[model samples]
Target chain A: MNESEKTRRKTRWFMLGAFVVAGAAFALIAATSMSKNLVYYWTPVDLYRAGNKAYGATIRLGGMVTPGSIKKLGGTAVEFDVHDATQHVHVKTSSVPPQMFRANIGVVVEGTMLRDGYFQSSRLMVSHNNEYKAPAKGHPVDQKTLRKMMESTEGIKD
Target chain B: MKTAWIFVVLGVAFLVAGSYLGLFVAPAEEYMGNVQRIMYVHVPTAWNWMLAVLYAFGAAIAFLFTANAKWDARLEAGLEVSTLLAFLLCCQGSIWAKPTWGVWWDWDPRLTSVAVLLFASIGIIALRGFVDDPHRRAVWSAVATIIASVDLPIVYYSVKWWNSLHQQQSSPQTVSSQFHLPLRLNAFGVLFLMIGFIMLRTRVANMNRARETALPPMTEHAGEIA
Candidate 1:
């Protein structure tokens, strides 16, 4: 190859090497710090594990709303137990829950754990699963059936 | 060029049929009810958006290695189409989020990573417009595209790797068989549309590049007047 062609080939290799190095560095950084920094919300188990550290700091706690635990304290204020398998946190929220909010549905509430016990949430949001099921045979699609379906958390895990 | 128009026609036909099935024929979801209909469009757009980004990444790599102007043209087409799909994906997600997630937007890892890549692609497209030198523009944009595309894996795996509000991806195994027909149809529809758009966009990019490389209009008359 001529001198110019040789130089051009060397430049291409250098560019390739730089890109590979940069890519590796990016992957390394993401792998190391992503888990720590990218958590959208903490589960009920995470709250239990935190112990005293979990108190007083505003945080988002996500889990299923326990069946039969939904209690309406008054207008726009509701209380429920957020459960994650073995662990559960009592969450009392003043904010109005979404239309889709119901028992045994996934929820993420943002607030602080009070000293007296129970999570005091200022914001409440529902998190739905990926599954989309049609109504079973002979069952009509109506408000009552939809409510019942929302209340049943069968085959779903936190 | 004619073949590109054929793909566009096929894409539109598929989309119409798929949408009819999704909107009228499919059953309402047990929990979400009719709102779940959005999934037929949203999921398909999301799946194709990822493919568009991948196309851009591949084109970028090919251009860098071969130093081929054709690849650069394809790269530009891929970037623009990816941006369009990403924008649509976000809008559809936002609409679905309101009733279900109780929020229009969230800073969760999955959503955030997608937004990051969308903005990165836009920035690269803007970079192409500012640079006058075709060679420098191609090389710089190609490198930028590859760099930005590192976020693709992160976007895909965000739900699995992090505590995201967004649920895990739904597949044939996860989704009910009854819902499969519309989903599959829409997926293919969007794929065809994306491919068609990319091909047409590539031609436009090629034409633009040609105009850029063409010699400046002869200035002999102006020189004589001077």
Candidate 2:
């Protein structure tokens, strides 16, 4: 075929291919995104609205760990409940908790919500907000007090 | 092409046997409980995706430098297989995430980057469809592959480099630990399946290309003497 003819042929094939791919992609996206029951994340509202139905189902519940609610049950076992302000889901785990799992820090608990409205957690994770650490606004290290305390304790031997 | 089935068989065998061993033989994770068993399959899917994407990147580079038609087919095969594996990886992650995070999906960096990469791969194949000339299509796709390479590192470090909840590599990922055997087997299983996917996809693309080229000439020759 001549040069222009070749270019025309190329264009046709390109269009043909594009059409096929586009159709396939549109279908896939539609299927995946439109999964109304995807069971991905449960907001406090979702948990409340879907309460009990969410029972026995494994899920990731996002919320702030309730302050003053963290109570150690034993050596390693601790009980804490998460709330997105609308609903509270208690979580129980027997492992050392993440530093971010304290009051007010956002946490995602992975586990099943029991029929008793508590989340029986197996994993505890903290979202380290270290990316946006601002300079310390409060008092710098209390170095003077530390020096006095250290001097007084100097008489002790390990 | 038929021989590619061997890898599929081998992959299924390894995945099943390794899963059984990892789930039943290994001691329960002290911290994560039975749900931790999901890690075996989840990790392997990520491994498969990485390897497949790496292969695509290399194939694209080869196409750019070698003027070889074969590399184009290979690149397409790599992308197709990797895209599927990536999809599976995300799904397995969701399954694991549900039990571990109490949610199936979240807005974490790792999750976001993977979603982007998957969409971009879909775009790449779509763009490939729009290119008519084989040579131009190859060159264009090579460009796409190179562009998509950025997503790899982003996904790899999404958790560490950002304020994401996803943990760093699982504790005891070290090969010297009890995970050594199961991990090796899982890795090998994923590898075999990946290669099998590439082989099968490449064969299909090759057959399709051949059919296109084999079409008879449009015009018949006229004899002057007649």
Candidate 3:
């Protein structure tokens, strides 16, 4: 081949090699990062199963709030138990919980599990259900009485 | 041309109506309350941006195989739309995150992958501008597009594949049925607008290429229209 043709061939191969190397490097980076950084939402049972592995790691715990397990600790801080039927994890949080937080509701807490068995939560999120019911007439939607009535009837045939 | 204009009008109307439904008609989310309304715009933009990238990816492959100028034109249009939508998605997500996540942004896997997607796509589109030769531009861009699209799946699966502050992907199975209507409406609205824009922009790209390559005459069909 002529000098120009040989140079062109070299350039083409170089470009191809560069792209292949880059693709491999990216795939490696993605795999490692995903494995290390992807935090799965664990239930109380999952947390218990994790045992020592669960301690001090920032993890998300999701479950329904155990009924009658809520307590106000004088300020924005609160304590509750999140249960997934099989296990329950006690959670304490200084942060104000979401407005929909309540007993028998699904929630996800983000924080660390302490040696004393309490989950110290930095954030609390209530997992809202999919049901949507219109408010009743003449009664304000925000009225405590109306909300209680709606909650009582929710999931039950009227 | 008329059909494209009709699409624009319909898209705007549906988007407005969907916004109204989301903001006023839909009940405040039990948990996030009123702030969840942002999902109307944010989710739709997220969905459409991926679709735009897929379009560009398909166009890139077709251009490489067929050496068709039309596919090149479509690839350009798709990239332009995807770039715009990706930027919009970031903005909307930031707004929603502030109240919900307590932070505007994080280096979480999902967010990082999406940022990579936006930058890589933008880079490919920008590279096209610097190349002057139409044939060279087409071939180089097609190669770049295929490489860039490797990020698309990473962006989509980031939440599932890694621990992310961003929530998992939502669908009919995951999202509340109540939110479905407005979400679908706005999704279609954005889709129609995206398609309309792509159609018009593709024509412009073709005309520009025709002007550049055609015999330097007023005899060229595109030149007469121009």
Q: Could you list the chain B TM-scores for each candidate?
A: 0.95, 0.88, 0.92
Superposed by TM-score, candidate 2 places the C-alpha of residue B121 at a distance from the truth, in angstroms, of 0.7
Q: Report lDDT (CA) for all predictions.
A: 0.83, 0.67, 0.75
Tens digits of per-residue lDDT, candidate 2, A43-147, equal 556777885687887876665677789999888778887766456778887656753345655576677888775778776654322111112346532565323
Q: Please list the residue runs of candidate 1 whose C-alpha ends up more than 4 Å from where it truly belongs after superposition.
A: A1-11, A14-18, A33-37, A138-158, B217-226
Docking class of 3: incorrect
Q: Which is the winner by DockQ between candidate 2 and candidate 3?
A: 3
Give DockQ for candidates 1 onward, in order: 0.43, 0.05, 0.12
TM-score of the candidate numbered 3? 0.69
TM, chain A, every candidate: 0.74, 0.67, 0.62
Residue B153 displacement (Å), model 2: 1.3
Q: How good is the docking of model 2, as DockQ?
A: 0.05
- By TM-score rank, best first, the candidates go 1, 3, 2
What TM-score does the A-chain of candidate 1 achieve? Answer: 0.74
lDDT of 1: 0.83
lDDT of 2 by residue, B1-226 (tens): 6678999889888988888888888655433456666667778888889889889878876766665667888999999998898899889888766654555677666798899889888899999998765667787887677667667866786554443556555444222255556766887898888899899999888887677557654412222335
Q: Point out the higher-scoring one by lDDT: 2 or 3.
A: 3
Top-scoring candidate (TM-score): 1
Model 2: how far residue B92 lies from native, Å: 0.7
